[model samples]
Target: MDSAGGTLYLKDEDIKLVINPGSIEEGKKIQISLENIWDKTSDPVLNKFETIVSPTVRCGPPGTVFKKHCILSFPYNAVNEEWWEFTLLVKENFQDEWRRIKLGSDDKDIHFYLHNGQCVVNLIHFTNVTLLGYTINIMKAARRVKFGVFGKHSLNKYQLRVRTWNSESNMEVTEDAKLFGEKLVEMATHIDLLYEDLVVRVQDVNNGWQISEASKTQTFSADDLWTKIPWRVFKFTRSDPPSDVLEATISSSQATNVFQLKISCETRQENIRSKVHFWYFISALTVVVIGLIIAWTFDNFQAFLTSHSGIALFLSGLIVALITYSIMWKLVKSATPAQIVACVFLNMSLYYLGVWMCFGFVHPLTTVNIIIILSVYIIAFLVAVVLFGEIVLKFVPFIGLLGSVIFIKLMS
Candidate 1:
């Protein structure tokens, strides 16, 4: 079709990428063949591009709907490179076409990128011939996957600048989901205790592919990677398998208590692992006693602090540390002596840090206030993310004890 001012025009469906742009030394030639139309019924039609284009069929009365499918193929002959890149120019109807339709301005060229291999283009069009305007959809499957449109139909005519976007929704809950409920009810042994079950879920969130048993290397955004899982509900049983598949098991037995697992920022492990720890009545009482002792110590030494601000800072630190320890307790019901000792020391250090900050142990000359503020904010955010993690541990009697022991040692 000819646009107003004698400019040439191509429908959106006809958009194609070119390959093998000639070098500066020699002229380059590219031949585009359009064929193989697919219908709405999923049937394919192999036809020549020239045979399908008719002036009468396209340049009709305004507001007419028109649709067609075609594949554009081109050959490549570059000295070394396998692909070519160029912009596709689109123009609308011939009669007064330029006035009725709008093409992208020079500043924003509609460029095309093509590789040497054969490619397919699916085109669909709707035209208001009287107005000399058209709506077009082009699906470009080339070395790079891209779908685009070009037409002066109207402003806001194309939202997001592209069309023909399709997504698959595979969220059907099947009969197997019922297995989760039945297992929970069957495993319940006492009113005060509940059996926690863990079901591993694995799915491709993006276009990336995943392997079954093989370690599937994947990258996640910082937010997605740091997002916390509900450890209170599902305890990590065994090490995460080195595959995309999730392995989670729940047990009423204390030995199988679960721990929260996070993706390591360094290695980006193929599978995230969580360990299960046990809880017992003895552990819970011990934790509660330590908490009381710490509270008393703070009360007895209230006047001994050098600065009120430092005291406030120390109290804040203690609160944050206790909250974090509580969360860790809920995360693990059992642990080795080394783990318990490590958690306890970490908690003590935090408690002392609170006291020191309030008492001005960290000198203002060192710019410690800035560091303290930032640290407090981080701890608060983390605690919010793992909200009620420790509370969940208190429900399982024996495991709850173990969780308390870990929580207390970590805090004390």
Candidate 2:
């Protein structure tokens, strides 16, 4: 963060992120990343699209919403399939459903456009989003079906929630609570019969699940789903797991087909915490403990390093630390996760190597002396961070000016 906000030139992602100044104050680090989801999972949602035109770019931490939109730009090659000419941006977040985001719609929070081959978007939030292509006919005609079955129960009312939408694709759809309930019975993909003016009719419910008297003969119109996935909850009295839930018949005015749903999921609930505070607590405690240990033994380490050879040996760690920090700087500028991880491990190894050198070459090892050596190495690591980062410059405001004239003389 800087006075006028900051821009991340994510060269590897071929994306740049611009943060509004007031959103984050000066001298704070913002961690954001883009991941290619294609390599990660065999997402069933991807199959529903005509073709995925671009690799899914996941800007993380997942599900982060911003007060104001950030500028997200992708290079020409980022989504440059031949199908891109007829593509739509399909976005998914922590929310399970994938929705279509239209192109060149100025009012949309997720609008994107191709300008001289570069796709630029106003990123309103962090989510996994990809450019998805649809057939020209499918784009011209929105006649597809996305259907699901969700389990529900309240006292004796054992229920099966049948949800349906136009299914061509949707945005502005709220997550269905029944499908993601405290006791969710995951159903396999629902059978769909694509037709205009379709109606879902419940013919029968048997084999341990009986249709409640109120819903047995009633029919549900697809017109109700035009605006959203209207929940058509049908309550059925049940005896534990049902061998058959319902025999649903989907019909248009003059045609029909039987769509049966049966999946024996032992009703389960996924209890996932969206945010983690445990690691942050552990990290803070470790830093405080390390600081206290260093303060306790730093005097002895200072006394031993008063001579020329000892000073030379101590300064030698700086050369290695400086090189490691430079590599980390480059990796972070581009935001390559794997390389950044490797760089951090290498830096830690080098930090420990300094303590080893102190024990091996200059002094006899003891628990008391080892703590002193560790403290010296820790201080050296902190000095490297101050030199290589903008932290000191931001606080002092004129550190560069003051240090330039006296750096060489001070080092000597």
The alpha-carbon deviation from the true structure for residue 301 of candidate 2, after best TM-score superposition, in angstroms, is 81
Model 2 residue 239 CA deviation in Å: 8.9
Give the least accurate 10-residue stretch of model 1, judged by summed lDDT: 153-162
User: What TM-score, over all chains together, does every model reach?
Assistant: 0.18, 0.30
Candidate of highest TM-score = 2
- In terms of TM-score, how similar is model 1 to the real structure? 0.18
lDDT against the true structure, each candidate? 0.27, 0.45
lDDT of 2 by residue, 1-412 (tens): 4336567765644656676765544565557665544332423254333444344566777766665677766543222233333444544555476666666555556667766645677766776666654434322323234565566533223455666543222221224452355233433233433223445455534455566556654445433432234556656554445332333332222144445544343321111111112332343345435534443454464655575544654454445445554554443322323454455445544544554454454344456644654465446545755566422212111221122112212223
> Which residue segments of model 2 deviate by more than 4 Å?
1-140, 143-146, 165-182, 188-195, 212-214, 217-220, 238-259, 264-412
Positional deviation of residue 271's Cα in model 2 after best superposition, in angstroms: 18
Q: What lDDT is obtained when candidate 1 is compared to the true structure?
A: 0.27
TM-score of 2: 0.30
| Top lDDT prediction, candidate number | 2
